[model samples]
Target chain A: MKHSKISNLAFTGLLAAMALVVFVLEAQLPPLTPIPGIKLGLANIFTLFALYFIGPMWALTLLIVRVTLGSVFSGQMSVFLYSMAGGLLSYLIMRLLYIRMKEDRIFVVSVFGAMAHNIGQILTGVLLMQTPALFYYLPVLLISGIITGLFTGLAAQFSIKALKKSPISDSP
Target chain B: MTGRNEHSLSALQWILIFAGLILLLLTVRFFFDLSDGNRERALILLDGKTVRTLDLSEDQTFVLDTGYGTNTIQVTDGCVSVTDADCPDRVCTAHGPLTDNSMPIICLPHHLVIRFEPGHGDVDIIAE
Candidate 1:
């Protein structure tokens, strides 16, 4: 039992580091669209994997750590609030959907999760700017979220399938 | 295992539903943008307060100092735009121009927002 616990901690720590690296690297790229709150969200691939393979708690921790560290490393501390809002909302929605659906349906969960993340960020924008005009961007964001979510979700799904088939066993 | 297969079917169904919903949303948004008439007035707000209101018909250029940063706004021929900004993101500047009220040009770092208001009556959307 102790050995399993240690392995779990080590695994989660590794995943968190990998997620942070991806987040930082993605941030370095030019904005895909002039519109804010739209991105590839590649780091979420790891979060989805951790959510299904490790557990919800570890996944949430990994998300929080990655967002916090990513913002700090990127030198855009001002965006940390928006990142936190989006990351936490995505994690919660993913967890809720995962509980209701089968493990094989993680891609769907990721789609909804990405939508929730966009909603959360839009809400933050509204709260910060105190304007409903931001809602105009909702449709554009929703479409982007779906497309990007599908990409990351499929990536995660395939990675998990391959990992399961690998010789090294995943930590429970 | 049976539960897994059944859930997979439902997941596929959900994905289809979401895809349709997204398509519908995009359609609605596109129509809404097309139907929106040209706006004549632009309201500039800094930190939730009305800093200036400009007539889009008039051609003018001005520099706004928000204390945190500066933005160069230009109004010409029924359009308004941020030509330059000191904010690191430059998103507002990159946004180019505003011919309608669909999306406000926002510089979050500077707490600056430039939105097109249809007329003077509903300009105070954000209550101080």
Candidate 2:
């Protein structure tokens, strides 16, 4: 049991590193549209995977570190607050739903998480800009969130299934 | 948790939720449609700074001083577009026009934002 625990921790660390790399790589991609808030949200696939395999606590740690480091490396430190708020809220919501909902219905949690992140970010934008006009963008962001979350959640599902049969699956 | 059924909602419920969302979107689009020569207002932001407030009712074109150079954006036919920019991406140009209230014309390097605001006569969605 002690050996198994060590291996699990190591595996979690590796997954965290993988998530960080994906987050960094995704930062280089341009937004799909010139809109300030539109993007592919490619890194979310890793977060969903981590949430499924390593569990919520591990996933939450990965999110915090990734956002903090990513913002620093990108020289967008000012955005750290928004990213933290969105990341934490998304992670918490995902965790609750994952714990409470049926396995087949897990994707719904992911969808809600994505929407929550967009809402959280938009709220931050409104506060920063000191304008209520930003609320108009809420609908668009929520729609984008639903689509992106579905794609990322599907990716996570497939990845988890594949990983279960791989050599790494024996770690725990 | 065994045989507690595990599942909360049936497949039918999921379908209903998606259908409802679609219906809401269509209704919003139908009511909020904006076209040529409509009077509106837009707020311009450069790197989080509110540089200017534009009135679409009167101003057809204006030059924004980006501290680097002057960039020109024009509002015509109930749409806003970047006619000229010193920025390298020229993304603002590609954004074309703003018809949707949710979509904004953004130039990241310049931190410029151009988003549509419905006229005062139009109903505010938030108020409802």
Candidate 3:
């Protein structure tokens, strides 16, 4: 039991690091759309995989660590609040979906997770700016979230399947 | 796998349902937004306060200094846009122009927003 616990912690740390790397790398790319809330959200792929294979607790920890570290690395303290709001909401939605659905339906979990993330960020924006004008972007954000979510979700699903065939799959 | 039997719809079905719902919502919003008519005035707010209001029918260019940074706004042929900005993202500047009230160009770093004031009237409604 102790050995498994140690492996679990190590694996969680690895996933967090991978997620942070992906987050920062994706940030370096030019914005896909001029709209603020839209992006590829590639880092979510790691969180989705960890949530499915590792467990909810580890997945949540990895998400928190990755968002915090990614913000620090990006040198944008203001963005940290937005990331926290979006990341936590996304994690919660994915957790709720995971409990009710089969593992094969991870992509569905990811879609709703992405939508929840966008809603959380927009809410944060409304609060910070003290304006309702942000809601004008909601429809566009919803469409973007669905498209990006599908991409990230499919990527996560294939990655999970590939990892299942590897020897280290037994560790988690 | 036993849990799967309890759910009537598959994942693909759920995705389709959501996609269709969102598309329908978008279509409805687009049509409603179009019926609002062309906005003749644009309001520039800094820190949730009205800093400037421009008549969209006029062709003019001006710079707004919001203490945090500067943004150059241009009004041409019933359209308004941020031609340039010193903010890190330049998202507002890149937003091109606002011919409709569908979306406001926002610069988070400077807490500046350019939005069209709907309805033709001298009474300006400050969005809260």
Best model number under TM-score: 3
CAPRI grade, predicted model 3 = medium
Q: Which residue pairs does candidate 3 place in steric collision?
A: none
lDDT of 2 at B73: 86
Worst 10 residues of 2 chain A by lDDT: A1-10
Candidate 3, residues A55-93: lDDT per residue as tens digits? 888899999999999988877566778789998999999
Provide the lowest-lDDT 10-residue window in model 2 chain B. Answer: B30-39
RMSD of candidate 2 to the truth, in angstroms, is: 4.3
lDDT (Cα, tens digit) per residue for candidate 3, span B38-117: 38888888766777888887899988898888999888888889899887667787688875666678887777888776
Model 2, A1-172: lDDT tens digits are 1236566567667766777677767666654666555566666777777777766766777788778877777665656777787788888788888876544555677778888888888787776655555565676677777777767777787788777779867644
Which stretches of model 3 miss by more than 4 angstroms?
A: A1-3, B2-8, B35-38, B120-128
Clashing pairs in 1: none
Best first by TM-score, ranked:
3, 1, 2
Best by DockQ: 3
* Candidate 1 per-residue lDDT over residues B1-128, each given as its tens digit: 35645634665677788789888988967754653433887789886677898888899999999888899999988889999988766778878787555567888777788876543333233321
**lDDT, candidate 3, residue B74?**
89
Candidate that beats the other on DockQ, 2 or 3, i.e. the better one: 3
lDDT tens digits, residues B7-121, model 2? 5676468647855775786565545444212337776776556677677666488788876555798977656678888765466776777765545676545556676544454
